[model samples]
Target: MVADTGKTLHADTLKPVNLPEPIAVDEDSAGGPRVVTLGRKLPVAVIDDVWRIDDEWWRARALSRMYYAVILVNGRRLTIFKDLVDGKWYHQTY
Candidate 1:
């Protein structure tokens, strides 16, 4: 048996998780991240991998990004991306 509850649920009530936030990045001459600022400036040690995603071309707002998986000098791994559409940098977890 269940109790009757008079309540409404809306899509807007939900929230997104791990949403990408804008980050400050210093790039090398070849257009790769050389340094990234989270709380402090962290130098990039090596780029582990790189990839690009160009999807939803038919949509008004296409999704285009250049992603980089890098290891910081402090041995911390991070995943970041450059929004090709907006020319901005963001850090996210895969």
Candidate 2:
């Protein structure tokens, strides 16, 4: 489905499921992992759910992290992730 600009219309969280190349996130959250800004901080939505993932056991140094798919009050969607190893979270704007 082509959108207004003629680009293929893809649903939010439509990225091919995969983790970023073992990168570090910013400040950790005490309230637990949660998403705030998305879409490059301009966000179409605010994350509502946080999902955790840590599979780099093979790479002992890689820290496992949490991910979130925020359902903004506007009904938009955004993805966020946090590192459990260090307790930091990063936002993935849709």
Candidate 3:
């Protein structure tokens, strides 16, 4: 058993992790990502995979996005998504 020390003890608060951030991306005529800009523009060397997610239609803000797993010309790999709702791009970890 622990004794009270006359000071309030608060539990650790929870916080969100890995929230998505907007990024700049250039797409091809076919609407596929051709370049991604982090600090500099990096051409996509290879597009390994692609998928889409559309959920929470009943909510005020629905989630709709097209995801891509790509390798850059500099040999770095990244997961990126295009928000179908806003037509914006973001990079995220898998």
What are the models' TM-scores? Answer: 0.87, 0.44, 0.84
Ranking by lDDT: 1, 3, 2
TM-score of 2: 0.44
* Cα lDDT, all candidates: 0.95, 0.53, 0.93
Off by over 4 Å in 1: 1-9
Task: At residue 25, give the lDDT of candidate 1.
Answer: 100
After the best TM-score superposition of candidate 2, give how far the Cα of residue 67 lies from its true spot, in angstroms.
1.4
lDDT of 1 at 46: 95
Winner by lDDT = 1
List, residue by residue over 1-94, the lDDT tens digit for candidate 2. 6558756766873777555433232233555423244333332244466666668688868758667665645576646566667655555544
Candidate 3 lDDT, tens digit per residue, 1-94?
8997887655665566788888899999988899999899999999999999999999999999999999999999999999999999998964
The worst-scoring run of ten residues by lDDT in candidate 3 lies at 8-17
Task: Find the number of clashing residue pairs for candidate 1.
Answer: 0
How well does candidate 2 score on lDDT at residue 46? Answer: 49
Q: What C-alpha RMSD separates each model from the true structure?
A: 3.2, 9.3, 4.6
